[model samples]
Target: MSAEVDRGNLRSRIGMGDVLVVMVGRVGEAALVTGECEGWNIARTVGRVSLAEAAPVNPEWLATWLNSSYARQWCLSRAKATTLQVTLNLAALRELPVPVPPLPQAREFLRLMAVMEEKAQVDADIVRTVPAVADAWFRAETAGGWLPTSRFGELVRIGGGSRMRPHPEGAQPGPAGYAGPSVPVVAPADILQSELAHLARTGTEQEAAADVPLCPPGSLLVAVREDGVRVVVNDVAVALGRGVLVLEPESEDDRYWLLHAIRCHAADLASTAQGAGGREISHRAFAAAAVPWPPVDVRARFAEVAGRLHRRARTAAEEVGTLAALREVLLDEFLAGGSRTSRGSSPAHGPSVRGEGVQESLFGMR
Candidate 1:
């Protein structure tokens, strides 16, 4: 960031529609084009906009730059002092710098993105049919094959638990001094995952220090407060935070199978929300939410397959996590103009125009 790019009275002097508010991020972290905005406030904030006349020459690459690993890392580095919580700065953000690649290079990036886009559309096709496979297995088994039927509420107790306070200042700093309730505090984002549940362990001393909620042992932690759909958290070692529901299913089969079932019905969960303003999800809404309950034998049968899906899903997630770690490693190398990837690939995943920014999906865990 430099002083010449600084416009001291620039914000207050701008007129309405004098600029376009440009938002930048991978599709996951940002929303754009909700509408146009322009003003002094717009110029001062990350989400605000102004006219094309304001400064258009070096702007064409803004979105791509934001999408770039170098740029994304820069934004993230500037976000906060801590690693766990995200905190973006407004003033520092507007002062940030970007490398303006020539138009030809920018077009090459776009062309590469288009190719990755088509391949990804194929990957997305599997996303649509997996649920039906589980649903049909349930139906066929409950109707005649192996499993029996019961009301969903009969098999599990679904309850929304203690309300959560947003992390007071960001990620809790360091060790909580002692180790009594070291089980991690969690959130919906934490459990939107596959494999073992992870929460940052709060010291029992910390719980005594700060009065935290207990995570249920057999509960399937679910994110219940979104408009029509929600995503599971991508990280482990986090707890079921606010805006989540915990399901304590009766049977071992339920433990093994309920996660898939809920994901199948994820849309319904979102639909039932009383989203008048901020997201509002109730225990009653989730408990009353139904699923196709098949007999025990049918559940056993479904579990046989779902167990495999769950295992494969877990492995896939682990692999992606490994790739993400690798992406970070290679990003550091390539961005420094290193000759090759640590993994031996010619060009690594992040720096080049690869990855559509959607996290690769894995069947979430219970």
Candidate 2:
């Protein structure tokens, strides 16, 4: 609520400088209203906070603070929770204390955040655009059923079936009486979480022996979920865990071709997944699926283009991760004034944003 808001005219139409807060489910998720979305209508479960035109606080800065971990806990603490959902009322949101710096300092803080946010948006766009482009190329080359087809099993070797050990450490054991080097373990969750057509790393690694199912770099990892068949080209050597299948291509040319081929037929392959869970892919059904096998030279041509697009996608995904981490770090630093910060470091004992030399170094401000 602001002094300028008319009581009768406060409709759902959003305005610039309005902060949209989720009132249900995710409770505290908030975003700043920009010019692009200024006139959009908000749902009933959303609460809009409008600021007077002469308000000293920046809307983006307020929105950023609302989305921080501290504010999340604050909102959740006051929200009414049931087994199914959590709901925050307007009164709780109105009581949230916001720390405001001078307009120029707040704007400077936001400028750095905006730079990282824009870079991340660009990378996210690449991750989404690459798959469509690659899929189009696949359809164009394989159109009209002109290329001779082959069973999927014949084109590549399928590998999987290493189970996770029941040990407390969650490590995967090898054949008895064997000890060897460790490699990152790819699981169903890893494949499902990957946004692009490539996977750069996994969260956990296990000691692998000679008998463990090992997928070398450049192999396609597939995870059949309830939604569809998820796939990614692993850029590093990784050991496979249960529910993760590896498709090993014989050459570099076959790599991208098989990658896109599996993506284009994701729905058909997912149809084979049948069980009580309906999330597991039947090996027999997958082995018999028809795949378009074009000439090696034609595949090489598609590979040359698709491969470049996927590689760029992977690079962009990596940058997205880096930018996200840095943004979180900056948010924690900015929001925590003289108290200990999330990274376990504190600014020189004074105001967090003003007149502190450390602020200049942290935000890259001159």
Candidate 3:
């Protein structure tokens, strides 16, 4: 949505509770607007179309239904080919059949969705608050000290990792003749904020040592993309993937402090990123970025405090993931069984559907 365009002649205005369908490119994507977007101008070139709910159909319920497999299949069947992408016009979308369950059943589904949404907001709040608190603490701790500001290159060695080709064959021994323990590989996606130990792939120790450098514990891993600069402290030794840069601090104990410092300057790093396809901070540029270098005692004390806060944030994030998974399962079950019948009647049972049992297990009720 653009605010620069004149809104006087625009007939269709999106408002709070409106559902938007991405009709082109990533064809079936849908979203519900939780806030007002009345004055902004929407471009049809982006392939977005707004939906307003009529009586007996809740906007939230309709948005959820549009995201389900049934709606996706329907949209795919009706899509027309464009020069470079598939698209569905508003007329075609109108022809897609929607299940109209009883009003009471629709209300129940909305109620459940509200609960999940509330929990998601709480999780987001926790994830967002910890970093802000840490940033503030860092500023306060560095305010009084005669802390020298040093380029990251002066305090750490920065290096990019290798792109290892995937092997076609199943699990075997080391790279050809070498034999040693399997080395876990860490990619940019595996590097979470303030915590890094996620291993998505594994390779032979020989391959890791020979082809790609292994980042040791206390190394800072950074993702150099425009999405945002993500920084994490590695808790264990692992082989690095191509998308991440490993920052090895001269003083191993300075790892946590360095991670927090980089995080504080994340916005600055992102602004300095340069590239055509995606904004990226080059290895040399990232290494030359300035950071606050406080006294050893101050760093150690801050590290201890920051570590505790980061641990709590990690736990909260994990809980959010679990809750999100539970919400997905509930949505699947609710849509499958609850949509088949009216309010009072029992939903038709099928071999693949175990809605009642799953709900009972989840809520401890039959």
Candidate 4:
């Protein structure tokens, strides 16, 4: 598919200003084509729309409406469920409704949207970049294997989730008589999908967390997938599911150190996995794997240095949720014609980061 032979021959090729919609798999995902993808072509599963010369809609506005909850629900309802994935037929896609406001109103809405999207993208980049910096530091400081090493189990407490009360099929059951605030239920799927080093949210929440022993923030959550091991430092209190393993540090000083240490040993831990599909992490094998055990002073120093970066990452991660909720509210108002008189506002300030400067500060040799 990456071959150049298909470049000029394909009719599916998209140019700037074309709107794209995912017609299959993750149905309803939409985007406006920019110069970055000038000559690129979409697969059979993707639908491209080239507007007529006199059409009254802007590509960005149309793309935004297609990505909204209203449009997503509409597409999902009509998409055909297949064994491997859902498929959206061309007829259904053609029937998708788009709301068009006057050019002035559309431009104002786009102005506000661009601001929020820019802020969210910066935070997303931070979530991905900070961990790489920390991992680089971990590799550099322990490069020559100067520190003494020991079995991973000896360095931290290893445990799994407790058994929950049985519930009827298709229903979620909480601890009896416990009706209170909800906490995220940390599942293997959540661990697999987490892009940030720290998890601030999950798909499922339960009031039963009040009765379950919540894993405090800062504990490491680990899961094994067919590809390899996945790990993240949880930011909020979360109740563990049956498939995840928790690595609780013995002291605050060891928290970040243990995090990077386990990450470094991901491949080694992954080799221990065994299951029907070779996807389960073997607890016995993982505990027995060897890892570098640095001295107390070394760990404390690394923790002190890396802790700041991790905290910033966590802050940005939390802000993403708030921004997302606000975006949805504004999107709904625009859809309902409730924001006709509203003028677009500038983006709110987000957590400050000096992009490459932060990396240099973290990776600068000691």
Best by lDDT: 2
Candidate 4: list runs displaced more than 4 Å: 2-12, 23-26, 41-45, 76-90, 161-171, 174-182, 206-214, 332-366
Error of 2 at 305 (Å): 1.1
Per-residue alpha-carbon lDDT of candidate 2 for residues 1-366, written as tens digits (9 for 90 to 100): 333443333476677777888888778888888899866666667887776555546578768877766677778889997655678887777777666666676787799988888989999999889888999999999889888999878988876645662332356666777788878888787898877877777767778777666788988888888768988888888877777777889988898888889899887888767666766567777778888998999999999999888878878888988887787677666555424464544222222222111111010001
TM-score of every model versus the real structure:
0.53, 0.68, 0.65, 0.77
Lowest-scoring 10 consecutive residues by lDDT in candidate 2?
Answer: 357-366
Measured by TM-score, how close is model 4 to the native structure? 0.77
What is the full ranking by lDDT, best candidate first?
2, 4, 3, 1
C-alpha RMSD for every candidate: 11.4, 9.0, 9.8, 10.4
| Candidates arranged by TM-score, highest first | 4, 2, 3, 1
* Candidate no. 3 TM-score: 0.65
Query: Candidate 2 at 228: error in angstroms?
Result: 2.8
Give me the displacement of residue 209 in model 3, in angstroms: 11
Angstrom error of the Cα, residue 12, model 2: value is 12
Candidates' C-alpha lDDT: 0.46, 0.74, 0.62, 0.74
Clash pairs (backbone) in predicted model 4? none
Of candidate 4, the 10-residue stretch with the lowest lDDT total is 357-366
